[model samples]
Target: MNCVKTIVCIAAVMGASANTALAQHTFSMSSEVERVENPLLTNISPGGVTVLRFAPTYAFESRGERYRSRLSLSAVIERTSDTTLLANRDFPSAGYTWGYAWPSSDLELRANLSESATRNTQFADFGRVTVDAREREFLTGARWNKEMTERTRLTLNATNRRVDYDTPLLEDYRELLLSSRVTWDHSETEAYYFEPSHSRLTPLNGGAVSTQTRWLVGTTRALSQEWSLDAFGGQSRVKGAQTETGTLGGVRLNYTGSRLTSGLEWSRDVAPIGAVSRYVRNELLGVRVGYRLTEGTSVAGRYSQSRSTDVATGRGSLFALSLDNQLAARWTSSVGVEERRSSGFGGLSGRGWAVRAGLVYSYASGL
Candidate 1:
């Protein structure tokens, strides 16, 4: 059967097999306005954006399982000194997740799906591409977990994704991933794990097909009452016209306190370029910190950098920063900026920056 049919069947099976006991559902709505300094990440001309956003979410539980879904729609009106360059764009997206737990058998399962329609020029999940394009994407995944012993556990995961673009079809592709992990607890707050994964990629409009496999070992440790660390290293092998091997690894550190929270994340890996039907060497670093000023007020800041290189796409880099605030449980706001620089191949070279600020008002109801 086709992939889309397979996905629908899986969803149907999950819903039919779940218990029918009913539970309350939660619904919420939120709105935000954002301003950006650059609407397109290119060297053409500096632009800005005034963005209006609306989001709604619903959640429910049945028996011992839970399900949730959200939809977000937004309109972005450009703010450029040149009236000819000023235009408006709209985006709509939907996402959902279902989770089930079998405590008696030490098993848990989760499934997720999302669809998006947007004009935003950023990295897409399926491939690398030019910043200016009308894009649509569908992604879905499932995970299974089992606790074998008090000190051991196992997990299995799978995902499928597809992408489409109105411009060039460089980033349009379909992907399937299968992965497994085994964990051993060394102590109450420390554990080690080994993971193996495989991925298959097919270009939508007649490109070469490729498959990749990866293996990794990692450890997670609670360093202190308020701090924790996770690190991993691995290797990946990709089979296309020729076989290529590369290293992959990542590190994440987190801290939580009564009034503060912070994190550092870094990673380097060999993965699909997301724009073209190829693979690349990817590296990223990010840091974030948040502080609470009162019972319902908090502030946070974040920064991140990413670089990617492939034989097909050459190299590119992106940097971003943001500051956020939450007040009185119902009001939230953020300001963010981003820059992109690329020495791309196939006439994809470009550089530019964008900045944005927005506020959200939210309300929730329970049933």
Candidate 2:
């Protein structure tokens, strides 16, 4: 949702001080190599190819007793990757963000300003390319996370973002979303979160406008320093009789150490459309393990499986595996493979595999 955009903007400006800091500022570069295979493989076919890529990240942040600030910058470049069963093309991206926040007497104010530009071609079909789609979003919000009683605390938040997308310029959606999230913080270990948000979609094309409403409720249990459990459910109702229902429930168990962490999780989701549509259910199982092999190197891997069901699409299953390595302080590399089998019209026995690698260079400092 638009919420992710809001969070990333803040993280960019506050730099990395909110969680971790790397001695004023840090920079690094990395690259990846890949190989893929598919039934449609050909000499120049979408069968699979190998590719090399690069990325760079730079950031600097500061923290004070009552104030914080950050600036984050990033860029990525890649060309005709040979390790993927996809098309051959070049794609690059960059972003800039600045943010600040201050705490006032009974309330807090946070502001973010960000601008981003991206251009890339779709791999499968060359005709349907995003000729031009860029976005400039600004967010301002206030929040309260104080205690009203010794046993309970009521939290509230509100935010606004102005978004602009540019391309052929035929269609535009400058939507306005306003929401207030309230939570009953029973204690540090037990809390209940409830949020109700609404959005109004105004078409720049001057067509009929639409509105949507969403309601969510969630609970969290902090079992220990390295383990937690969460459960949440939400519903989205459109302007018409169209409605979407979602349910999320998950349990996480992890063992943590100074240099190693491992976790296992399971989740289930169900979505049913109101009208002439389909009902879908997803069952997921995941496992993750990470180890800091040395001061400058670390390794991690994950495995996941999912089974989905629907009306028209019938049923499907997906299995994926991935591994990541940290090198030379500034270099991070990863490779992953995923296979999916599904049934539908024109559906054949097929699978897709992706192998990716990239290099990045970063430089940042405080003035």
Estimated TM-score per prediction? 0.78, 0.62
Cα lDDT listed for each candidate = 0.64, 0.51
lDDT of 2 by residue, 324-367 (tens): 55544545556666554333323433444555554444455654
Alpha-carbon runs more than 4 Å astray in model 2:
1-23, 36-45, 81-146, 158-175, 201-210, 241-260, 264-286, 291-299, 304-350, 357-367
Worst 10 contiguous positions by lDDT, candidate 1 = 68-77
lDDT tens per residue, model 1, 9-71: 554566567655554545555555555453444445466645555565545434434443222
Q: On a 0 to 100 scale, what is the lDDT of residue 231 in model 2?
A: 70
Error of 2 at 87 (Å): 6.8
RMSD in angstroms, all models?
Answer: 4.8, 7.6
Clash count, candidate 2? 27
